[model samples]
Target chain A: MAALRRRVLEVLPDLDPAQVTDGSSLKELGANSVDRADVVTMTMDDLGISVPVREFHDVRDIGSLARLLRGHLG
Target chain B: MTTRSGVAPDGVVVTGLGVVCPTGADVDGFAAALRAGVSGIGLRPATVDGEAPGMRPRLVADLRGFDLPGRLAGLPQLPETTRRAAARVAGRSPLAIQAGVAAAVESWLAAGLHRAELPGERVGIVVAGHNLTGALAERARAGYQASPAHLPGRFALWYLDTDHVGSISQILGITGEGYTVGGASASGNVAIINAARLVAGGELDACLVVGALTALSAMEAQAFHNLGAMAGAAGADGPQQRCRPFDTRREGFVPGEAAGCLVLESAGSAARRGAEPLARVAGYAARLAGTSLPEPDLRGEVGVMTEALRRAELIPAEVDYVNAHGTGSPLGDDVEAAALRAVFGPDRPGPWINSTKALIGHCLCAAGVVEAIAAVVQMRGGFVHANPNLDESIAPDLRLVGRRAEPAEVRVAVSNGFGFGGFNTSVVLTSTTGRGRPSAARR
Candidate 1:
């Protein structure tokens, strides 16, 4: 989850890293649709996980996206 | 500053200038480099990630250390919201857009738009940009390949040519008309000419003309290399001597990046707003060659210059200086020299000609406007910077400026720009003192 939040900060440089906590909703952290999509795709690619891009729309927070990546790995 | 007599009371005049090039970051800096005859052309770094260690790119004139946010920081009067928005987008936008925004902001501030007093609905914007395939597009394509299921929402808007004008207009709050002009290398002149005509023809009070190109892709460099249109690739002295325009040893132009902006306002509007005029957009003409040749035919080139001079109501002999579109290619320089000889006559004392491209490699779409700025700088500074590498003259009849800067009283100046597909544009500019303004603001 911490790594996921870090990747989210990389995609959205305008946002503050400290405010992008695991429990922070992506939208609340100033992640627009494009920013959200880039964060999910880049993180997934880094982790070598294959998930349908449409499924990223359902991701609400950094923790949930991390959990989804863990589920795919298992 | 002696005023030339032919300027109409209703002429279109340049109120301000903004520029970003390898030579300098702003207008004054660019002019100083021009006056000193400095060459910004140098070897470019490899764009590919894993290239051979010893590989060096062909000649390139790039803005090595330009940072948009840092530039914006120097202009603090702009609304914080506007500045932040611009910086945010520029951080993620294409390089060309970032360059355009920076240039436009400089021009805007110079024109006093930061004062927030101009009517937003009456001002227009026209930016010239060519070559759509570059690093941004290459990266986007690769990103799509890596993840076909997801594409960035702003992907399409990023590359579209209109977005250049759109981004500048949105930042500055110009609500009038916005569009882009492109005709390969001639695009810069085409855009400036059209914008001037629109203001002169009474369609708009003022127009912002900008030319920006940051697409220095290795692929494009390779394409030019494959065509044997690049200097220093085969038999050449070295990269430093690659772009010697009008010289006998000239091979081809070095690829360069630059963005230049000029604010064209009607004479009446400028006086009303108390804006100091820099120069007058006296007359302009553009001609499209019927055929698509890699090199231009001198006939079309000759016609464009004559037509522009005729429209300006001036004879060929009245012009004192010429900003020649000398691309440093053997064929291109010869054809352009022949065209000038035909226009100015073979045996008569002709206009003193110089190529800004020698200092800053051919800026493609930005060449025309950048050269126009050079002309204005020369007219105001009372001197002309000679072509640094023009050792052996190819155009004997034409009087080319020499190696060192010379003291010349430039009354009337002409700038010529030609593109790949036979697109040629010629614009006539006269010093602001010669135009409709008072001499109180003379610098």
Candidate 2:
């Protein structure tokens, strides 16, 4: 989880981690479709974790997405 | 309305050109494609099934392989290259700058006009774009999603709303006036015309016009796919099937991304620098058709073209070539053809016509200038290139050149760019020598 947090921070240092906690909504913080796509593609390239395009269709929070990536990696 | 006459009022020349098109990054490659009647459309491998289907809207002049140097690459995330490009042209970085501001400064430098030659107060800037706010929104989202604690780092909103204008002013050090305009694709043309007006009125001796738009994100691409507006990949058919402009089987337009800038100065100033004048901007006019987004009013399109001619004091016969706003969509093609017929009459003889979008794909906000560059090339070359992928004629009286270039004694050319909201713009370009007129009279 800490590794995920650091990776996310490297990608978007301007984001507030507290607001992106496990249950926080990315949409509430202005995470749009373009952003989500960029995050997915950049993360896949950097983290070597392939995120299914469809998963991003409904995933709303950083915590949830981290968990999804962790499940896939495990 | 005080209507002025002659090439002087219409005589704003194109001294220099810079391009970032798919065919070739510079003017030479793009000119070659136009001469050879090449089609840039091909299958896009990245698109998925749920997206729009057909031939993937690829540029007959693909820019995918062209790489900007590492120095220029930083501009998408930072403001450095935009500044450097401007400084390379302007001799100095503008104090505070915007994306479009650097472009304007570069254009002025390309024109060989020095900053000290003209009064800074007499210089102005007009820029156009469709997605300024959208860019900010995307950046803000990226920052927020990465971490909630670094809210201040995602300054997309602040940068877009405030810094855009501030940066431009700071770079140019223009204390006079500046503004942004457009209705989507027509924005660039509209901005050019606005700057021309200020210069003609003597309110400013020089005006810089800039147009730019970024690439569509996956979501925006999907939105266009949902609208059934994108051209899909060519299947078993060859590459020519991808985007058949003015063809009987034409399907739709492909979206592209680009930015361009032009500096307009009075003839006196250009002459002072011994800069050879290119084609002149004779007349410009814009009109709106449908009140809504999807619907296009054909009548409005015809009216605007006719009005542009009227403003230039030119008859239909005077126009030698037309750089069409043909997007390859069925309705768009038919309606634009009908509008041309209405203005030119069904019997009008061979006036060379073509669409640059067929070669480069549609560059959204940058479409106007991209096509404008093509028209200037045609005017200088005295020939109109044929349209590739045009297997059969869609309009009877109109000449749709295919597979071969045709010679033309082009005196006047018109470029049209119609945006989503039925925003239509027609710009007239005339030869520097005033083609048909006597030399002494032209002087």
Candidate 3:
């Protein structure tokens, strides 16, 4: 969880990972379709993990996105 | 026997054209860009310091190299300075004065009507703008931040006090009725409709219709960001990728700056003055959607558009092409497509449809006149321009022209411009020399 938090923070330092709980929504954090694309692209390049774009549609927070990424990595 | 006063005279004709857009500075370049399906979207060199989160829409047909006319060249180059000076002297902002003069000159030259020959007092002007002056707001912000006492009188000078009609009267020496209409993107079309009514009623021999809008300031940009409307960084996919209208993957609209002008004259007056007609203004109509701002009402669009066609005595089949008010927004694109399908029907031979917004970012209030120019050019030149980056098919057999010009016999074309607050307007244009009823009979 710590390693994933660090990784996500490295990509979007403007956002606070502390507030991104498992139940947090990206839309609630001011993230939009454009930001989602950027985050997806950056996550793929940095973590060598591939997640479908639609998976992020319902992701509310960084913790949920991280769990989803872990499942893709496995 | 028909009554004399009750009978409507011949409709007005478009005799001249002038445009300043990101794709080209004049009608020729604008037309060529459209015909060639060139995309004008691009990354703007950072003009200011503030990072707008998300997709930063960069694709826009920007007028980067335009030189002001000799008369306007002496005015302040910065919008803030110009607005202040113009307000002090003419009781209006500088942008209005400059735009008014440019449109008047272009219309006059296009009509081949010498200013000296016509009654200058009878020539009227109507102009539309979305924002007052972003540069002025920027200056005020910087000044207040630096020191409270540094605030200049220039901040208050940004008001466009002269209505559209007043600006035209001052610049072109016109004395007839002049007024500005404010209705979001439909502003330009509404102005043109008003001008046409006045000309058709024999209220004026000629009228100049102009539309102009500038880029958003940091504050305005932030407001758009908050609305979830800005394209964000995904717009970096290249200029052509910035605006995709009617495409299923479409995201949002790109902001752009532009100004356009058309010289309209009554057919009788044009003939008397030996001026060549470019296209005839067959019919004009406007309606409101009663919807919230920024979202389109498909039913309203269909009702007003069909009514305009009916007024012109045109069936859906007679329309050869449509210049769509496709803003590239998700909701807007869907609504517009639905409206087109409803009006023309699912089975009819669909008119070639494309968005001028694809070539130049949404020019806000000026979009109507700018798109009208595209329709006029296609009608006169007999070809429909394609929409770029339209990856998703809108509807089967809809014929949304993409990335190429298609040759067609365009006897009649409909140009639509819908603005915020559900202000909807549609203008119909027909070829002057093509197979149609004589101008006299239509009158």
What DockQ do you compute for every candidate structure? Answer: 0.34, 0.03, 0.01
lDDT (Cα, tens digit) per residue for candidate 2, span B110-171: 56544346556766667666565554456557756775434343243344523434455556
Best by DockQ: 1
Off by over 4 Å in 1: A7-18, A21-32, A60-74, B1-9, B45-57, B140-153, B234-236, B346-348, B434-443
Q: How many angstroms is residue A6 displaced in model 1 relative to the true structure, after the best TM-score fit?
A: 3.8
What is the Å distance of residue B257 in model 1 from its true position?
0.9
Model 1 chain B weakest lDDT span, ten residues long: B1-10
Which number leads on TM-score?
1
CAPRI grade of model 1: acceptable
Evaluated on chain B only, candidate 3 has a TM-score of: 0.86
lDDT scores of the candidates, listed in order:
0.80, 0.64, 0.69
Residue B428 alpha-carbon offset, candidate 2, angstroms: 1.0
lDDT of 3 by residue, B1-443 (tens): 11112213776899888777778756788888878887777766544555643434344555565555433443333234333333323332344345544555565666765434467656677676656466456755764675543333334434443444554464455666666767777887898898888788877777788876555665676567567665543534765686788887677777777778888878877787788888888877899888767778888889878988888878776787888888878888788888888888866677888888887888887888888888888887788888877777666568798677788778788888888789988888888877864333343
Ten-residue stretch with the least lDDT total in model 2 chain B: B88-97
Candidate 1 lDDT over B198-219, as tens digits, reads 7776667778999877575667
Q: Please give, as one word, the docking class of candidate 3.
A: incorrect
Please tell me which model should have the higher DockQ, number 2 or number 3: 2
Give me the TM-scores for chain A across all models, comma-separated. 0.80, 0.65, 0.63
In terms of lDDT, model 1 sits at: 0.80
